[model samples]
Target: MTADDFRLILFTLGVSAAAIVLSLPFGLALGWLLARKQWPGKAFVETLVMLPLVVPPVVTGLVLLKLFGKKGPFGALLERSGIEIIFTWKAVVLALAIMAFPLLLRCIRTAFEEVPRHLEEAASTLGKTPWQVFSRVSVPLARRGIAAGLVLGFARALGEFGATMMVAGLIPGVTETIPLAIYRSFHAGDDDRVWMLAGVSAVIAFIALWIAGRLTKGRHPF
Candidate 1:
């Protein structure tokens, strides 16, 4: 592979990994909440959380752009701090995180829900606090599902193109990931490069899906 292609692969891997790491904590919390809690606005909240899966990726990216553009509230504050996010590598990470969040949350929530509540009750009876039971009993039992979720989320993020393109602008060396690279090479009539990149992406995606399947096979989410 060419140096540029290698750079794209490395950059894509780095940014996608970063996105997953950044999202994992919040995903865990939200997953637990959705799986275990019952509140007045719960249905609305679930719909909101799931909106991204149904919404157009470009629209999601546009919303992010408006929220983080230089003149926008969060963007302006960051701008004063001299940290640019729009169309940067950071944008790529952010797009990946957002785009992949729904799948991650769904898998995590299913994992948590699959944990028998009776086990948590048993832990509580042993004088465990809710948090303690969650940490010691629930999380351990749900590890496989969590792993599956992470793998699936990574795959989704790796394949992300629309939202990422909208937010990150597909800069050649800076933000071009595997999907973007494939698109670019195809347009440039570099068929050989396209095949190489496409093959690389397919292999990675296949591995990810295989692992996720192994982790969650025969486990149906409610």
Candidate 2:
């Protein structure tokens, strides 16, 4: 592989990792709350979380662009701190996080909901703090599920393209990721490059799925 190809692969990996790291905690927290608590406007929150799954990726990207572009509220605030997300690797992370968060949340919420409430009550009776029970009992029991969610999120991030391209653009060596690289090569008629990158992505995605399955012990039922 050429240096460009290697660099592109590395960029994809880095962005996917960043996306997973950013999305995991938020997804888990939201999912746990949704599972454990009853609150007003819960439906609205759930719909928002699931938006990426249902909305066209291009639309999602466009929304992100508007919200994060220069002169946009959040973008302007971030710009004051010398941080720019639009058309940057950070944009890729944002797109991937948005796209993958729902999947992670679903997995985590399911895991959390499946926990036995009696165990929590028993822990409370034994004088364990709420945070202690959550940290020790609930989390440990759900560790495998959370790991599976992470792997799935990573894989989803790896394959993300539409939203990423719209927000991050295909700036080679700067924000170019594997899927974006494949799209560029294909559109440029560089069939060899396209095939090579596509193969790499497929392999990586397969490996991610394999790891996720092993972590979940095939509990996802395909």
Candidate 3:
């Protein structure tokens, strides 16, 4: 690859990493809620968590746009605070995080559910606080699941296109993630760059999947 291609790849990597960093904690928290809690509208909340997985990407982008665009509610708030999300790298991160949340939550919920309740009870009886039990016992036992969730989230972030494009606007060196760049290039008839980017994205996704698989091996009881 040329230096320019390498630069583009780096941009994508940076944006994807930023997105994953932003998404992980929230995803874990949401997943824990889904797995450990039962309340009114819990099923609705679970469905909401998975909404991004089923919604059309363009529609997702439109929803975000309406909520966060320059004249939108949050957009006005951020504008008042002198912070902007539209047409920026932060916007890309936001879009990616939204799209990746479902995968991360799914992985983490599975991990949380796999933790035996008896163990938690045992820890509680030993005077360990609930937070301590969660931090020391539950989370430790579910590290592999968390890792898998992270990888899946990262992969989803990496492949995010429509939402990123709509939010970030395909500005090169500013908001053009690899997936968005590929779409732009293809539309502009830049076959070489399009193919190269497609291959690069595929390779990156495959690597993430491979890492997830290796981490999951022998970790699940089944």
Which has the greatest lDDT? 1
Task: Please give each candidate's TM-score.
Answer: 0.95, 0.95, 0.95
Clashes of each: 0, 0, 0
TM-score of 1: 0.95
Task: Go through the candidates in order and give the C-alpha RMSD of each one to the true structure.
Answer: 1.9, 2.2, 1.4
| Candidate 2 lDDT by residue in tens digits, 74-104 | 8999999999999988999999999999889
Alpha-carbon runs more than 4 Å astray in model 1: 218-222
Candidate 3: list runs displaced more than 4 Å: none
lDDT of 3: 0.86
Q: Encode model 3's per-residue lDDT on 1-222: one tens digit a residue.
A: 788778888988887788888887887677777778888998998898799999988778888888898799999999999999988888988899899888888988999898888888999999999889888988888889999999988998889888887788888888888887788889999999899889999999999999999887888563
Quantify how close model 3 is to the true structure by its C-alpha RMSD in Å: 1.4
lDDT of 1 by residue, 73-169 (tens): 8889999999999999999999999988889999999999999888899999999999999899888889889989899889989999998998899
The count of residue-pair clashes in candidate 1 stands at 0
lDDT values, one for every candidate: 0.90, 0.88, 0.86
Cα displacement (angstroms), candidate 3, residue 157, comes to 1.1
